[model samples]
Target: MQSAEGTTAEHTAAKGRPTPKRREAENRRRGPVAPPPRTQREAIKRMRGNKQSKEERRKAAAERRERMMAGDDRYLMPRDRGPVRAHVRDIVDSRRHLMGLFMPLVLIVFATTLVQNIVVQQYATLATLVLLLTMLFEGFVLGRVVNRRVRAKYPDAKDRPLSIGWYAFTRAMQIRKLRVPRPRVTPRDAAKVG
Candidate 1:
């Protein structure tokens, strides 16, 4: 009744059957399977499906970027979205801001720091710190002005608590050529915002 390993075989006749091939046993262990495409056309068709998904992703990204650039509220960041923010951007863009010179001034300060003269370096550092602090104060004042204008224009806006002032101040600080959602108004139109 017992075989070589001392295990009982309920059906003695089944023991006479040949063992399954290694490959067959392995395939069975692997569970469900599908054969790969056997022809070039089939392979191409399968690859096309993958390509389509990649294309879809690329298109979606492009559309999102376009929406962001166009100032679409849904696609814009929380800080940059809404009508009040758009108006703020327009106001900041239209006017000449003192903070706009910050980057260039900082670059000039950096250049000055490279000088080997000890006294000149000390004076340059002092001057740079003073200039940066002055610019910061100017930005704060400009932000307050922009905030006042925004509050006056949109008294009933639900998002009035958003940092519209800081947003305007930062936008104003950026060089016009590098600003996103390009400035719609010129310096001549700056006076009309309020």
Candidate 2:
């Protein structure tokens, strides 16, 4: 206990610096290195000083949008964040589903009904009903298949079947060219289907 040569009598490395307090360590982690503000006005000025320039923010937003369109996880919406949803999207994109024509078929039916001929309108209505039934049937089958495959791949996935199943169904119904996070695989490149 009587050491005098700048050495501690204790059995320790003795770097001679006391540990930093938790609050100080947290502040350092938060990236603010200035001394504590002596007044409220200084604190307000510091807050405003931390903000980025408008150009910097715009560039950052554009970059984030690009990443989102490319299906980068960090920028994806909450509903699209997980690998399970990505797998579901890929599966839907890789296949040719009849429901993918639903939008075009609807337009065709609408156009046909604009004609004055009763027979043409009747036929258009009939065809529309038939297409709806077919789309529903195809969507049901696609949902089941995709859900099974997703379960096979991500067995421990926390996603519920209805959530991802509907996601697959809705994705399958969209026009391939218009799907967001554009198809990673073409119809011929479905290597991940297993």
Provide the TM-score for each candidate, comma-separated.
0.69, 0.69
* lDDT per residue as tens, model 1, 1-194: 88999999896466776999999999899998867999999999989998999999999999998887777889888778778888888888877877888889888888988999988899889988898888889888877887788889999876644377678778988988778766778878977777
Kindly list the per-residue Cα lDDT of model 2 for residues 1-194, writing each as its tens digit.
65888766876678888999999899888996668999999988877766656668889999998898899999988988888999998888887998989989999999999999999999999999999999989888888888899999999999988888889888888888887777888898787556
Q: What lDDT does the true structure give each of the candidates?
A: 0.83, 0.87
Candidate 2 residue 104 Cα shift, in angstroms, is 1.7
**Model 2 root mean square deviation, Cα atoms:** 14.3
Q: lDDT of candidate 1 vs native?
A: 0.83
